[model samples]
Target: MKDVYLFSGFLGSGKTSMLTDVIRQLKEKNLKPAVMMNELGKLPFDSQVVEKDIPLKEMLEGCICCSGAEKTEAQIQSLLLDSNFDVLIIETTGAAHPVEALDAVYSPLFADQLNVKGIVTVVDTKLWLHRQTLTPQVRSLFMEQIRHAHLLLANKMDLLTEAEQGQAVYELQGLNPHAFILQTTNGRVPLNLLEDLKATAQVAKKEIIKAPLSAMQLGSCLVEFTGKEFTQEQFEEWVRTLPDTVYRMKGYVPIEGIKNPMLFQYAYGMVQWLPEYLKMPAKLVMIGENIDTVPVIGFN
Candidate 1:
């Protein structure tokens, strides 16, 4: 069976950066790979970073594990019929839970045409270590993303010490004992890790790993923002004022007089800013404990 690889990771887990490296490896080997990316927000930024040569398709504004699942199934079918690519690489939204996302591909329609290559979930080791203090629902959602992975890419290894890295590996191993764990820096991993041959054994054993229904139903709200162009100063102030319960905030915003979209991210009490060029809408999505306390700001 031809293999279809699903890449699952949490927000800011470096999926795009890692995929860039993987694409280069595939090219070097003359491996024909097609891509299907799921972006949770309407404004898709990572697609631009991907190399233009590869055949790429996208599902936006929804997680492929949920609302986008049917669309994903149809797209994959379309890609298969339309192209002769050797392997299909699907990079799912950080919010995508493997348990749910797998449902999209396990249909009888593609069973013969496609083989489950294995779900490779990426973990930001730095954040993994400190995320225990988050609310139970958030914690469960994070754990749910990794529960059925055939491989776990322990990313951001450079941020940890030797002992901490070991601990991260151990933690991931414990999270999904069936998974093969590998340490990765900046999302780069050995090419063999992405190969169909390497994952066959694990994929054969993968069945659904379900989380509690209650926890599965609860998660951070997907907030939509519009009608405001803020000054740089105002934007900074607003992010700083977000609720303590908010652990992650990311997306792009338009600032007055700035030619490029202002990339924004907030995590672990710190915020980062970057000027990114994308004509997409300015939308901010935050995943955390309590989103109700998040406030909207107007610079006018």
Candidate 2:
């Protein structure tokens, strides 16, 4: 069985920085690890930050809590089938709820093969204090991630005053009494903390089984198709016919007449294109609200 560790946090909360460090530590211990990164935009910012040798799988344009969950599970399964990794690290989008993402992994398909190691919530102490006043949705998402974490990492501690840091820790303790809390700058916590921390052995499986499907429907819908190749004109025509419910779409597409594969990203009907020199297998993930994947079968 492989340990699945979830690294979740708000925007710019240092989740990526922490993840890079964690991957380095895992490699030093001779553990084969795979990474799954969920991003809000088409840009693979975090992916570029990781070491080139590490295996990385990405789900973009949709929060993990939404249409991307199933795809995430599928990717994990594929990685497990193809490689002999000892652990899987999932770095979720800033807006995602950690619990919902965790719920997605507890599917019957993965129940016997994967174990929940611990949920690590990285917090920007300075930003978290003012988050409540910005927007209700942001606050809800932040709280959800923090509340579900088995270990809370107070990152960017240098940005906060000593008293502010203390206050934040106290508040976090109140929210989750069982979580182990630590403060660090740029997510510099000891590697031992990650290796030694474990999930509660007696967690009720029913809790995961009972989470409503609606809770998982918190983000846009998405469908991803991968194959050896796809035509650019064919992909463009398919995008033009996308439903109104579809708000965001992105992924790598292979087409003729382009030296490198083309990258397409759409948000609220606006689309952008990027030409990349390097190419990989043709894979695309589309994101939208209430998107019906059945209607887009031709693209697959």
Candidate 3:
């Protein structure tokens, strides 16, 4: 059986950057590994960065829950059959619920083939306080990601002061007393934190939090596209048209003339782009609650 590590965090928490570094460290230790990325958007930026050296696969279009439990199990089985990797690393989307992601991995189909070694939850020190002020749905997502993690990586520590860092750690501890909390910069926790971890003797059951009626009233629609090329300007215009209700959008796109694919990330109304070479075919995934895909694709 292969060891599986789940890496999860909220938007801009540096999960990818940290995972990339971890892969490099694993290589130095002579460990063969494979990565699975659950990207919210069409582009696979995280996958591209690691694919150059490690075998990488991606699950796009929605969160692990959106794919339903069975499909995720099949995907894991297929990846194991296709590769000789000793470890499997899954990077969940920023808005993902880690508990749900974990539950999916424990599905009967993958239980015998994959062993979950640990969960490393990356926390953005700078955003932790502010996130509490957001809607309950958003807050729940962030908390659930940290709650059951075996290693709570309080990342982006450089952004916080000594007092702020201490307070953040304190709060995280309150949320998950069993997790080993560590301060890190850019998601750089030591590799030993995961090196020898074995899945809990029995998979720990996860607590399910039902969305309140008001929260359930808000819904999201996800659309995915796979193609060879996209115009940079058009992509920007298309994303700009997203409605306010569209809380997050992420993915990668290979620009027509640019040498590297562009990573697109949007949260609330903030947007960021990172340009890098494409290690796989071009794809885009968009997530918008109560929004239509017509304008999103039309812009491209």
Candidate 4:
């Protein structure tokens, strides 16, 4: 098993900028590292900005925790089988929930090959208050990312007044009483502070990560159904009727006589699907206001 670190944070929380720094720091010590980036509806163009030559995997168009679990697992397997990287870092979508994503990683299939190193959550102090003021659905989604994090990184400290910084730290501690709080100007934290390394017991000297991961990205409720297969027409109709609150929905579902699990993505007020993957059983994760209240497909 190799060391695995998961970076959990909301959108615009500096996960990408921090990843570049972490990769360089890891290479400075001669460690082989790989990166997995999750983005919404597109490839992580940010990968183009990474100066390092590390191997990168893109789990695009959906959150790994809910609808994209299988794709994510497949990518992870490919990385471990094809590459010689000693460390794996997964940067989740900002809206993704950390709990479900972790479950997919620690599942029996990969448990023997991968070890849990840490769950590092980076937060932007400048936007934290603004996000908090959004609807409860949005707020839950935002707070969920930090609630169960091992470390609550209060990034962008330079933008806040001393009193504001103290208040921000207080809020984080109030949510996750056990997390280690450190203020950062731009996601500038030591990689050593991330997780314990078994190859080097000396690295275990610090105990920063301990909190467990929890369910993911907010404003969404996950809906998965496998009892019956769907006709192509039925599937399309179901997607079209999705309520307005369904901001994003994606997952795999079995199709009648198709023999392939259909992969569907709905975001930006449009829908797209690929029949090639055909990884089915219809697992959908919907992120938006009142996902539980949406009566589109009636999963409740």
Q: lDDT per residue, candidate 4, 38-109, as tens digits?
A: 888676687776555788888777888877877887888888888889889898888887766654454323
Superposition error at 261 for model 1 (Å): 50
Evaluation by lDDT, superior candidate among 3 and 4:
4
User: Model 2 residue 210 lDDT?
Assistant: 17
lDDT of 3 by residue, 1-300 (tens): 677888888888899988888888888889898888888888876677875667777777777755654566677878877777888888888877765676556533234455566678899978896786878998888887787576788988888889998999999998877677889997887788776554332221221111121211122222333344668677667767766755555555677877756766566677788875655323333333223322543322
Q: Tell me the TM-score of each prediction against the true structure.
A: 0.64, 0.66, 0.65, 0.65
State, as a TM-score between 0 and 1, how close model 4 is to the true structure. 0.65
Best by TM-score: 2
What is the TM-score of candidate 2?
0.66
The 10-residue segment of model 1 with minimum total lDDT is: 201-210
Please list the residue runs of candidate 1 whose C-alpha ends up more than 4 Å from where it truly belongs after superposition.
Answer: 196-300
Candidate 1, residue 9: Cα displacement in angstroms equals 1.0
Local distance difference test, candidate 4:
0.68
